[model samples]
Target: MASHLYGNYFSTRSQRVLFTLEELEYPYEWHSKDFARGEHKALPYVSEHHPFGKVPAFQDDHVKLFESRAICRYLVARKPGHLTPPFAGTSSASLVQGARFEQAASVEQSYFEPPLEKLGFELIFKK
Candidate 1:
């Protein structure tokens, strides 16, 4: 696999990763973790990939990464001018821009994600 994505189709976290890959036009092999079979919770996969046993783990030739947003950021960094504006230098403007980006990302993680994740869990996974 050129790159591999381990996730279920319906997971929002997985969707974020998929959207990033699509936006970047990057190709990856999708490995669906069968939720019905409890495959994501298995021993070696969980231990080696995600200790929390979450879906949406990613592996490319050089690295293994978990967390959807982190994976997206990594992908963007690989081709820095796409998806996000590059923080290319240490000029005052660049520093301020980088800080703003970090703050916005923090806001999404802290304020935006919890509620949406809860809603998705209740509506889709709670059954």
Candidate 2:
């Protein structure tokens, strides 16, 4: 079965997942959630997709997931050698490359996204 993404166009989080899907050339269906009407906050979206009523909830044949980054990770892992370094091999160089990739991802999540989100909220959403 094809994957399904429940998200809003206005959500950057949703865009992230969408971008990942496109970059990986993954076949999927998009379900646009109406944030203006609070569709994300209502059932059965809240119960089935995201507990916090967030955008970019994902479902595949094998699993269901929320959070854009996690969904992106899963997608990338599904089709390796495209967005990620080849760490499947047991070589030391490959291990180091994988560690570096994880470090960079952690830095972006921990150090970059928070401030950038705040800045976007202040500069764009607040205005």
Candidate 3:
């Protein structure tokens, strides 16, 4: 029920949410809000869903959520299966793993963003 996806297959953030949803076994409505075509900049739905013009945002029950980690945590709490720990009754090791996951996720973001930005310009813009 949250906002739908709006990015291509190669979008790491988008893929992360999709895989989380899949692991959670939650059905969702999916959309591709392609930034390469400037839809995130010009589309009305883009503004309606995400004022900041970012992808992987979600809408549900009139409440909106943003960011990939937030979305993943949301799904994990709402439809937790085996992909993540429980919402409030998590144990210490689970909490530690959660922290570790977050650390790795942050590192993944830090590691990939610049190269992807360069590749984006090179592959999509430098023509």
Candidate 4:
């Protein structure tokens, strides 16, 4: 089954998912949503793609997903060993790596992204 992404190019969250897809070298179709025209809030986009009318919605085979972080995690889990360490093993080293990965991700989400997002919004959108 083919993978598909419905998102806007200007959306940072969409960029995150796009980066993950590129890093994994995953093949997928990109359906660009026209934010200017409120395409994301229309029709099947809101009803089928993303319930909240948000960008970066993804579909892989029968699985539909939203949230950039969730999409990245699903892509990583599907194609492991490139962007992440082996998470399947029950060994101590594997567990440590997994914990570290989660910690770093949490830090980025909680600490790094919020400030950057706020700054971007203030500088770009607010202007």
What lDDT would each prediction earn against the true structure?
0.88, 0.92, 0.72, 0.92
Candidate 3 lDDT by residue in tens digits, 1-127: 4445555566667888888877777777787776678776675765577677777777666767778778888887776567655334478877888788778778867997779878988988677
Whichever of 1 and 3 has more TM-score, that candidate is 1
User: What is candidate 4's lDDT per residue for 11-122, written digit by digit as tens?
Assistant: 9999999999999999999999999899999997889989999989999999999999999999998998668755758899888988998999899999999999999999
Residue 111 of model 2, lDDT score: 100
TM-score of each: 0.89, 0.91, 0.66, 0.88
Better candidate number, 1 or 4, judged by TM-score: 1
Ranking by lDDT: 2, 4, 1, 3
Candidate 3 has which clashing residue pairs, if any?
A: 2-59, 3-58, 3-59, 6-33
Identify the superior model by lDDT, candidate 2 or candidate 4.
2
Better lDDT candidate (2, 3): 2
**Model 1 clashing residue pairs (backbone):** none
Model 1 CA deviation exceeding 4 Å by range: 123-127
The sequence of per-residue lDDT tens digits that candidate 2 reaches over residues 1-127 is 9999999888999999999999999999999999889999999999999999889899999699999999999999898866975576879988888889899989999999999999999999998
Candidate 1 has an lDDT of 0.88
Better of 1 and 2 by TM-score: 2
Clashes of 3: 4
Off by over 4 Å in 3: 1-3, 86-101, 111-127
Return the top candidate by TM-score: 2
lDDT of 1 by residue, 83-102 (tens): 87767699999999999989
